[model samples]
Target: MIKACALLLLAFNCCAAEIEGLSAIGVGGIPMARQEAIQDALMQASLWNGAKVEASSSVENGRVSELQRVFPVQILDRYKLLREWREGSFYHVMIETDPKPDPVPAEKIAASAPAEVLATPVAAAAQGVLAKPVPVRECAQSDFAYRKKLLLAHFQLQNPADANDLSHFQDGLQQELSRMLSASDHYLPQRTVNEAAFNLQPGFYDPVLQPERVRELARRYGTQFVVGGVIRDIGAYGEQYGLAWGSDIRSGERKISASIPMLKLNGWMPAVAELGLKIKPSSRRFEADVYVFDGASGALLKQQRFADSATGDVIQGRDYIFGSRRFYETDFGKMVEQQLEQMVAGVDQALACQAFAARISRVDKDRIFIDAGSTARITKGDKLQLFRVSGSNQLVPAVNGDSSMSLGTPEALLSAVTITQVQPLFAIAILESGSIRPEVGDYVRFSMKESR
Candidate 1:
């Protein structure tokens, strides 16, 4: 049997072996049992693929000594733990291994090989069969490395109760949303806003005026997008247990008394008391209205209502307790995490597809300044294209013959400019080519492959 196994082992190399066996082991108490199980599974896979062990022996007089030698093969990089559990006293694990593809063999051309073998179709197919595979791009990591800056506002509470609790909850909601976006490879950390920049009265929050106000605020922050919204409702609500009784205290002997008469009789009395109470687990519900704004245009790009609920199951003694502190352990936290994930995903898709543009604030000699800054992911050494309005109807003689107006295509005015400095709200760049000079209000957009 050993010789047969050795023959099989010699048939395949360590790097190109496929796993085909089962392994089970008794696992004792360990802090890292799951990790240990994975390791054991890997070991079994290695041996099943094509690993071997050998022993050498030497004899002198009547004494003999033996030494063991083990030849180990490399294991698969990708594998799945199929199942893991404890049967009676031993923990058993099963694994499925994924092996790499076999190497292609070189084709040999004979002197009398048919001309059809060298035909385009046959030749191409043969070359493809032997060609190295093209590497697949990892979009998640690449998307993350793309630089984009954003700003998030503290979401307002709509119809909020005049209490401090609601305020804290609102703050937490905004923080969690921001945290989700920060975690992605999509956008950078939110830019901090200087509150004193926007001083306003009541109507500034009104629907008719909010967009313009938000636009102004975005300009000050120098960001591409501003996230703002109101939380509609967020709190833990109670669910009735529905006519159920739980024993608060078990029945036991409370008191006993005994008396003995001189003749022969004795009597004893006993008393007991038990208490019962009603209890129920409370459920938490979180609802919020989320919105995203294009900072440059002050236009509402996206609005969504995110909601989640969970059973507040943390128990304290005989009663169940529910609060924000304990919410993380409940299902509500998972729901919130998932919702935030979707929000970040949406932002990434929109930013990647949207057309981005910025306006020149001013120009000084060869240096130019634009109203977009680091908040919009403007990085130093980045290149941007320049364009100018041309052939507008305003150029027509207004007096008699032609008074109508028509917008014209933007003419290429200048070559790409290299960004030199980036501030919170704007960036400075120097033009590298083209005769047309940049002026205030000229439109600028990122050069291809420059912005994420």
Candidate 2:
């Protein structure tokens, strides 16, 4: 990551007042790049001092010939080019400025009072007071994690033979888990039929996995994470017995009994007793290992095993009261729902531990546009922090699976902003403080909390 420093550079010899500035430039087309760097530097300096400066430039062959900036508040005491270098596509230069030896007269300060930016010519404004670019930095642990679009794939069954219908069990678990997750305040779950592989090489699991393929699926769904799981064990269990009822024909009385029938009891009776089937303490068990992966990097973020069981009673081969036995309404469904509840809570908590941010797409005067909108749980009147990019670099692999890493450190805070208008996929905001102007590709974020 690149680090840009902004501090008090130099003090005047004769005057008590001090002024300072630091600026860096990257490579583009030679003339254009230099021009941009110089302009940005001046604007950054102006932001620090909160004063507008005037510029005069001479052009040569449609390029910059000579450029001079005049600070109406004070004169420059001294200046120096601190450092210059080339990295990747950017040519960086850091410059520092000092204040003049003598203070300006009071009447001069009054005469050069700043005017409205719109009243100036476009050329002058462009070359005039640009707010200092805030430095971009690594997000702290307290950073916000936005609710993201997510996809839950069908869980693979560890013991397929244990499930009478593998597809049904997988679908059942997936749907229930999705329901629970969608109900939470942590994520916006997206339903998808995409199947992601579990293991790369042949292992105890089925369907060979390719990490790249999983990432592609996530991209297609515009989701930040993909959830998958394995059904480790599942089964339905119960015992059945017979109950008997007898009637005394003469007395018109009836007797009912249940017993472990043996050969020694009252021998037998015809048309006096009837036997019916009954189930005792029937139960269904569900156990699964759930895994969550980063959609951008295909790395596992969380994993856990969750299990639960539900029990019920049956009489005459039917529910004790409902008089029917259906898959969805039975103990199996109840047990599955319980398992999903646990899984959902686990996933919601895990994802909330991550930081979330939206990128700036455009900037017009005091208003800025962000890439996140209603889908991301952003609303009108929400306040967000703005960061300026100072420097960034790709992280090299120092250990296994670190090749995809990148780092950016923000140096200064621009200002807070509030959402003024919201669309389905984007939002527009205006700065609460105009001391710093936001730029495209800057980051905006807010702290996340559970609403429910």
Residue 126 alpha-carbon offset, candidate 2, angstroms:
65
Q: Candidates' lDDT values, in order? A: 0.50, 0.53
**Any idea what lDDT model 2 has?**
0.53
**Which sections of candidate 1 miss by over 4 Å?**
1-145, 162-167, 189-209, 238-281, 314-327, 355-363, 369-381, 387-415, 420-428, 433-443, 450-452
**Which ten residues in a row are the worst by lDDT in model 2?**
314-323
Q: Which candidate number has the best TM-score? A: 2
Using lDDT as the measure, the top candidate is: 2
RMSD of 1: 25.8
Candidate 2 lDDT, tens digit per residue, 428-452?
A: 9887666676787676755322121
Compose the digit string of candidate 1's lDDT tens values, residues 1-452: 11111111211433543333222331213212333455455556555544434444566776777765443333333565566766554456565665532222223211112233323353435434333333221111123323555777766654454222222455566566667777664565463333311223444442222554555666666556777655555555564343322243211102222333432332232221222233443565666656666655455666677777766541222121222445445465556556667777667655654545677889998889987778667788766667664433223232453222111123554555778999977899887654657877676764233212
Cα shift from native, residue 28, model 1 (Å): 72
Candidates in order, TM-scores: namely 0.45, 0.46
